[model samples]
Target chain A: MSIASILFAALFYLAAITLAGGLAYRIADYARTPAPLKIPTTPAPTTTGGVVFRMAREVFLFESLFKSNLWIWLFSILFHFGLALVLLRHLRYFTEPVWSWVVLLQPFGTYAAFPMVIGLAGLWARRFLVERIRYISTPSDHLMLALLLAIGLSGLSMKWLVHTDVVALKTFFLGLMRFDVEPLPASGLLYLHLGLVATLMLIFPFSKLLHAPGVFFSPSRNQVDNPREKRHLAPWAAEMEK
Target chain B: MAAEITAPAYRVIPIVPALKPDAMEGVKPFVASEKIQDALGFPGTLPDDWHERAIAKMGELLKKYRSLKVYLDACVHCGACTDKCHYFIGTQDPKNMPVARQDLLRSVYRRYFTLPGKLFPKLVGARDLTKEVLDEWYSYYHQCSECRRCSVFCPYGIDTAEITMAARDILDAVGYGQKYSNEIIGKVHTIGNNLGLPGPALENTMEGLEEDVKEDTGIDVRFPIDVQGAEVLLITPSADFFAEPHIDSLIGYAKVFHAAGVSWTLSSMSSEAANFGLFIGNYEQMRKVALRIRQAALDLGVKRIIVGECGHAWRVAYSFWNTLAGIGAGADDPYALMLQKQLDQRHKQPTHICEYTWDLIQRDALKFDKTKNDHLVITFHDSCNVARASRMGDEPGGQFDIPRNIIRAVANNFVDMDENTIREKTFCCGGGGGLLTDDLLDLRVKGALPRMEALQAVVDSHGVNYLAAICAICKTQFSKTLPYYGFNMRMIGGVHQLVSNAIILENKQ
Candidate 1:
């Protein structure tokens, strides 16, 4: 196959999948019904400082995270950190000359990919093994984990086992990032890895994985726990009260 | 055919006495119209700026909580939380459904703030803030009891209650609070209680209880009020002062204290345990109401405050009093610090009302005269706020045994409701979330139907005569609602009421 055609195929396939995934996410969010309204009775701090402190406690310290099972907590931290590192490393492919840090940590990236794969596997296993966790896990949960593992393994294989022309790969990735048409080089393992990662990114927002950011927006954990002592009328109840 | 074989026309046998002419004179069946007019200023035209002011206040309140702002802005409307509500399960009304209910608050939030909502309102499913939408929010939000039951099942734990509360707060900010609620708030501010009974009235009530104690127990139980230098101040709801069931419960508290020989007095100023501010989403009001208890405790020179058997009252006392009253700063607040200090200072350990009450009954192997309560076949209704929200878990009324004990103590014919009726799955009385107003009676009756039906199922077979409930409001609601549903069951008092009836008074020579 011609180099230009291969590049074009990879670029076009990635964009299509990304767009499809993004649309699916938007649809799921729109289609999903909201849970029932529950008014918590706990006292919440009313000051701006109080609210900021609470957010900080939640985001950085995972204040509520301590409430979850220990094993789940460990796996979550590992998987999230590994996933973030891997995403950072992927930026290496889109640069003309691979970033200096990416080059320096090429070995570290390979090592980090192993844990990322293992962490995803551990999480999937734990979900299946734990009865309570298993009950809550949906089909999408298992699929996301399996897909993540595949992407990590394929990327590692392309980097460590199968030799790919680095210059050709960089050119292909940069072209895709810049919205230019380019064909991928005939690097079989690279295409497989790129295909898996691209698919996962597109599916990211739609899946339960979105809970990572969604928790912050949840009212139960975020709102202050102030009890109502004074009588305030709900506007609807005002007329009835009068 | 033998004459015996043919049953004669059945004669109506009336076993009970005929009703007296003035049987209904003093009985107040919660009237909504009067209360609505007196407290809420309802039916009258609201001020011209009311809507604008309320919406503006809502926006400001939303802005106050950056976290709430994010949550209100971030909801993807995934309906996974729909079937998780007890209210929705109890009532199939779509308005009672959480998603539809939350949409009432979320839509307004979106229209006011979000960029896409502002630019392309239709594209985002956002609509302009209208009176119709406001009415829907008002109706449905009130339907919610602010129970966190759904949060337990939610994947993201999105609390719909927060939206409801915020909505109420905004309404209050705009001068649209309900009459009953506003009146209660006014009372809490002015008289230190929702009931609006002042110090002299409280003392008089205590004196009446003292006389009742003398009549019943022979022991001249001093129901002291605001007595300085008392070791502990027992704070309870005003319902205990005059209300039927709760009054007995209050006496039960005094008896336990007397039995244990613990030094405690009721503070006339802070007789109520319930903090109504919880219903309206007003934090400052909550603090002000809670402050009375702290002030009373300090003024009376008590070492500790023992909250009474009120649901939300106990919740506020235990949960927030320490924080808001400066009784405790985080873990090291004054309530805790004082409690610890008391534990350390006293040569003997002091007991909480729950601990002391349970211990006294258990320690004495207290026997009851079932004949005193034999007039009714009673079934216990576990108050959701008390059984679920409070410290009670499994050891009897911590979750299970207390009510069972109380029921068995009262009537020989005590029968159980369905298993879910007793414990973790106990249904609310529908009067909670401050829906006890007369206008909301229909909704409350509808909500109480599930519990009523369960009670009726047993009453149909076993023939329940009385519905024993713990919380005062539950008792009040049951007394009114049960009769409406064609069930002739009387609202029996709490465990303490049973204790008062059953406990043999020492013979006065």
Candidate 2:
């Protein structure tokens, strides 16, 4: 294997571990922290089933954002859904004899890159165009958007602009999954795409991207509105009783 | 100061105003004095090591409350909640925006707590917690009403109220507490109520109310206090005993109990339902204040505990009372189980007065003379805390529907304000979350802009002559700010007051 293959292999391993282990630690932190009171925004679900439905609407439908702004909701849905498809399509590399669904999703996911890029552009444009959004945005906000946009554009370039050896690239990724080493494709564009994806995974736990897991733990969205029926006692709060 | 302030014009639709940076920078509530701080178990004054204390407090809170840690990290600055704040609409201040208001604390939280902020503070907009940043937290956090309107719109449910509460909690820990909330909390701790109304004085006010009701309706509606062995214990804000429209609601509660023939009494121990401890965001203090109700419940041996019309009060009672004081069921703790067994469980452990009245109205237990309120064309202003924070009855959105149901039953003409400004999207009374002090009157007048504009639309189209609210703070805030916008302060009244106007007594001559 070339030095580049060895370096990329090590980088991917580190990124993967960071993504998995970091998320595990952060998620454990959230779960362990006690929500002392039931503070679901009113008109919230009374039952566990109802709360599941509420969360489903919020997660899948962007229910609250849809209520807030049409433009933001449209762009957010485009970016998130398109990214989901693209990520799913990328799964073909890891599975030998790729799943039938992955085979079916190949064409649609390739096209999804356009909407993903367009959505990121619209969201990034608002950071400059909208005054309130501009005021609240930091350098990191702009960079996060730029990073995603760069990743999408580079990934697309490999397919349409500068074609790379997909079979060899898949072998390299599949090799990374196991202990065996394989030669990486010499395309800088492929390296750029992989590098950005690795960066996103590395930062996922520490950054605002924690919202992915944070939403599931949010008391206002996830809690059942049954404070009157059940007593929610935190360990620390309960300790005060003794 | 009053002469210098001008209320925003009434717009048909509340247009998000142009950003005015630092417009409300000078507005800050008076700092709590040593006596008040000590009474509430906070530092007597701003400690010498306040910066360290504040940071330590934030760390402590992050572990204690999931809402704080999640919210501080979850915000991606989507700007969904930017125009959602009434203070932003009213003052046109960028800092008043919910996301920006949260960043006042979140920026500091990021700086000290997170790795990226420590490595590259400028990139993430994190800043060291300086005196200037602390001052900003004091000014802007007080401006928020803790209404949770922004939370209704946030994709992640990033409640600025939770952040505000945490910021205020940290502020108190460093001995930099706001006078209004801290003093009120002190009063609740020492005097058993926010107003410090003595038991004898409360009895005097009740006697005056009884006489007035007798004169008007020729019925002896009793306002009993400290009566043990009653079927229900009524815990209401002290404002009900002293303030207009609020006092009228007091009379209304009395008439309802009189007509229903349910035995009820108020307790001096927990005379105040409005918990300022909630405003300061101190769990210990909030729980301390709430324990009075449990003590009252035990002493009075009341079968039911029903709270009167006060928004945050009802929220504390409805949402947090069970957790804080064990007023609700499904607990194994000795204290919670003890109170749970003592109180009647057939009804909601602590029911809102609106829920109580609506249940009676639905069962055809209460009679009403709708014509009594026919003279006034009415619209209900859903109090922010009650609308967004608490629920009533068994169904969801019961808080919104129950009050409107009671209004339609009592009043012949009823109209609602703009759909955007009512229900879960309700605007603050501009004076909620301890911003009602005289020092913050300018901020109050400015923050009332969106709500006042919404009321103006109804008045223009539906000829709304009276704006009824179900919160003591909303009633009091509107009564003060209405005249500034060329509306009569008398236009502000309570839902129960409307019920009082129309409620017919069986024994009245």
Candidate 3:
């Protein structure tokens, strides 16, 4: 395999794994904290069908997203969906022959990548423009967005602009999948993209993005609101009071 | 002219025999004893299954979900929540500690759900769900009024109220509920009222109220119960029928309706506005309790239902009524349709009782006869349920202006408590969430101290004779807890009383 191709493939895989591992650790740490969840009670059992509907609404419609500032919602939806689709398309690199459908949809994938760049830009602008959003946005938020944008732009450049040797790239990935180490390729842009993607994944679990799963576990949403007729006593309390 | 005999000069004689001296004396002692017991602490006993069921339920719920399991798993044991709680602030007891309070549920949660808890329980502060643990939860969770104040300050936003509520629900499911809560729920289910005062009692009370209005103001204001075709069904807590402050508030609503010449009726079926289901964590019961008001409105064909000045009731009414009643279904529920129609028709929006009362007093320029309320030197206590959860921040329920307006109307010596005592920052009465029973008296007293302290500030400065509160539970708590704390203040009549007292008597000849 060409040195440049091997370098690019190795960088991407390393970045993704490193990011995912870091995010998982951060999420575990956050889960340990005693954050207050003070959602008002409703007399509906969260598990009783309503919860499924609510979950669906949140996932598909982004119900709370819709309720949030409209511009931010638009940017978030585009960026998230775009990022997800691009990741799926990248699966061709690991496969034996470039997946036929992915090959056919190369143009569409490129088109989708464009929105990832635009959406990230819009979101970054919004953080600077809006008061409350800006107030809450930490330095890490801006850095994360910048990294993702750089990753998307670089990937787009590699696919459309550079047109690097495909056969060499494929051979390099196959070697990596087989645990064969190859020498570095001289694609500075590919290395930059890989680094950005790695950083984003590393930061994911520590950020508010962990709310993706945390919302389900939130006591405000999960707990049933039937307090008028029931008596609740904690065992520890019972002992201490006694 | 000076010697003219006035109408056949009959000798002065009593037309009817007076009560026997012994009988009259006997009636006084009977009344005095009942009053004394009510005023003093009367310790009541819980049922035999109360403790067992509570523990079992707590264990069962802890076993039900991994989310709760995770929550129990997640506690870092920060005591930051302690000072944030109004109850703990009011009461200096170590048990009032928030972490200590949450440990009531968390320890059992840990013992039953976590791996470390199951294998090496002592390592993680985890203990088995014993009867002692259940009793502690009941005591501490009950101490929490579920006001959500601590949650606001919690950095991670760990809501102990949710824990307490979850524990309460598990306890209720297991039949370890409080008597007052259960009995009230039963009454709400059976007779459609919390007090179990059936249709006859409701009618009798309304009729008596009519007579009192006639005798006092010569206005002959008719309190129509179960009157069909009324535009509004005014639902109030049962305490309004018998409780002092609430009764006055009831009269104020009647006066507003009378003055507005609006068609309204009181539902004998769903008389009570306070729903303990909200406190106990029973959704079905909460729905059933709320359903009564909607049913009454539907049965009577009223366009809208107006809930009275009860805190949780308004919260339930505003937040859950439409969802629970299946309102907005295409012709399946006429209540929702009628409510929509009423909303569309009204020039003024339908509002909380507070807003309505306040608006009327402002609109009419109603001058209160200070002499009528001379007995009261008043300060207001804002119920937490109303001040925080309900729409008190912006529009102040329908009667937002009512409490302040009413106090000013009735008492010549009206006094303001601390700045935070009235609006958004008001402390909870601590007896909300069905904690008004004798079993929770200590917690209730402690919880009420912040509020009591605020009131005391006003009382000391203004010599306040009465603490005006709108919620029935708040009234009950304050009425019981005030004297215990050496605050000689009584619950002045609700805002409605001021309206009834101050409104111009139309029949004044």
Candidate 4:
């Protein structure tokens, strides 16, 4: 019933609204835009099933980037999969009587922070170390890396050094998920972690984080290499026919 | 030996040119003259409200193309594709890096459209639409050949070709069109080809080709022109009518038609297959040039349309022609529907000449004496457009293999260049996408470095004396730039040029 707890709860709701609504609008805008040509990068799949498989390799494996540079690929895949595992771990905070699988993943997800932080550090180094990468890095690019690094390091600090009231933290997150409001923990560590998470959510809709959803809508990856087999005409382009 | 044109002692292609930071600085093509710009229906010069109009055009295109919009947003600047561009590798100008080139437009796009750009432009590397920004667009966008080599390496498949095209389209909208492509497109409209050969000149050139073939092999291979009711209408580059290595490929096509007994005629109306409309990224101009092919096809009453060895033209014909001018199937309207009903469904409506010749070699319908090409050790330079943008012979990698298969079938000694440098990962010939003009000759010479390095490796080991290509631009580029790399210029030619060297012209049993 503390004022800080109530304010934090309201902030979470606002963050959730912005993340969901902004992403929805951005995605709708992307879907509404017409891809006027079939421009799948070559040696690409010819069938719908093959395209799905190809996309799976790209999303899961970063196949093209793997072919490009081994150094970047290793760091990228490690960071992404580690983040995915850690996200699964965070699900325990919102679910009551956490699922048995979530209980099982607790230790492995805790250890995933190593790759997550190390991977981010490696990528950050390339922003300064690699000549080509250094030349192209904007201020926002380094800022994005620093932000992610802060989140990862702070979360690890809570796990290793500062022990917060985890039971109350779960209660607070679960209350936010449900309509019932509960008091948040009074630990500064807890406040810092929740604050950074909320900031990422707020920026998610506007930032380069759109790459996550934007990759799926990329015409080059999504389109089948069948321009010769099928005549793909956008609606506006089809108007030209008449 | 065709002719001795030895390479210079100084190496224009020295191990990928050592990445000099500003090796190709301030290199830009001449601006399109007002007359040429007006011919393509673009503004003759920059109007007073050019900035607003350019931004408005970018906004329209962003809404119209998901590729452009998504590519603009999706690039993470991970630099995965930083070293992939041939121009960047060859010139070492950081701006030539695909991501940097994309960022040129993306910064402007972000500033005007995205929130971060509007609020805090410096942080996001976004800038206002200004004269300097417009100049960078003109310089860097043209530096790109629209080859899509960057897309092959991008993790998200962010095609810089798509971005380059969109940028070029925006530039053209604001009256900053390049002279090379716009002027060539104007000529194609007026005189039926890029060379501006009138009907009389075209007819006379074909006559001269027929006589030359008779003297060479005692074969009366007819180079028919605008013949009514020919079985196939050959849409080749006008350069094939006059240029050295290109003209040889023309004779090869003529000989193939004669040997196969398939009647094919060159169109006086749509004689050129190199559509500069695609080069300038003008959809209407591309469509207008493409419509000539369809019109000629209808008038001549050809059953099939076989495209000549041109890179972007095949991309247009295979990909956009169906959508643009109804040259292929899947059209609903009367214009496309009529052609669909009239043209032969047995063959691809717009088939590649390589696919045509390969089918003959596959069917054993054509005969080649391998010993005839024993003097040459051949290798194939996969044309960028055919390898990446288009397909051949109904399979996914048919574009890569069919040409190689044809080369192996014709030549006694055939070896592929470095494996990574061939196929879908092929480099541009440096002269593609309207860079073939003299103004960008430095870029043309420099961009040939990676490809020349790959060719030199083969020459040092396997002695690949002939670098056969399928694109007219590739042939012209290598012919010009090869001598600078200490290789003979005549060593570069079309894949069919090899076929012409080895094919027995006599009626074979």
Worst 10 residues of 4 chain A by lDDT: A225-234
Where model 4 places Cα greater than 4 Å from the true spot, the runs are: B1-23, B507-509
Query: Candidate 3 vs candidate 4: which has greater TM-score?
Result: 4
lDDT tens per residue, model 2, A137-165? 99999999999999999999998999999
Worst 10 residues of 4 chain B by lDDT: B1-10
True contacts kept of 2: 0.91
Chain A (candidate 3) TM-score to true chain A: 0.74
Ranked by DockQ, the better of candidates 2 and 3 is: 2
**Model 4: per-residue Cα lDDT over B49-121, one tens digit each:** 9999999999999888999999999888998999888888767899999999999999998899999999999
Task: For candidate 3, give the lDDT.
Answer: 0.59
Residue A173 displacement (Å), model 1:
6.2
lDDT of 2 by residue, B1-509 (tens): 34587787665456678898988886898999999888877898887899999999999999999999999989999999999998998888999999999998999989999999999999999999889888889888989989899999999999899999999999889988898888888888888898988888988988888888889988888999999899999999999999997999988998999989999999987899999888888889989999999999999999999999999999999999999989987888787988899888888889889999999999999999999999999999999888888899888999999999999999999999989889999889899988888888998998898888888889999899999998889888999999999999999999999999999897732
DockQ of every candidate structure: 0.08, 0.89, 0.03, 0.74
Q: For model 1, how does the per-residue alpha-carbon lDDT over A1-242 read when each residue is reduced to its tens digit?
A: 47645655665566667667665654454334232222331233344466567667655554444332345555655666677777777678777577888777666665777777777787888666653344334454566677788888877787678877877767766776676655567767766776776666555553344455666555455444332221222233223212
Off by over 4 Å in 2: B1-3, B11-13
Which candidate's TM-score is highest?
2
> Residue by residue across B1-509, what tens digits does model 3's lDDT show?
11221111111331111111111111100011222222212112333666565566665544443334434443333233444466556544445555566766766665664454576566555677666665566566666777755543332335566577787676554434555566667667778777788899889888999898778777867789989899877878888887766787788788777766678888888777778777866555676777777667668887656778787776666545544443222222343455444442342223466666566666764445678777667777766666555453133242244567666755676777777445645678878877777755655665676676676677678787767777888877777777766765355446566556766644322
For model 1, residues B179-206, the per-residue Cα lDDT tens digits are 6666777676677777989989888888
lDDT of model 4 at residue B172? 93
Give the C-alpha lDDT of model 1: 0.60
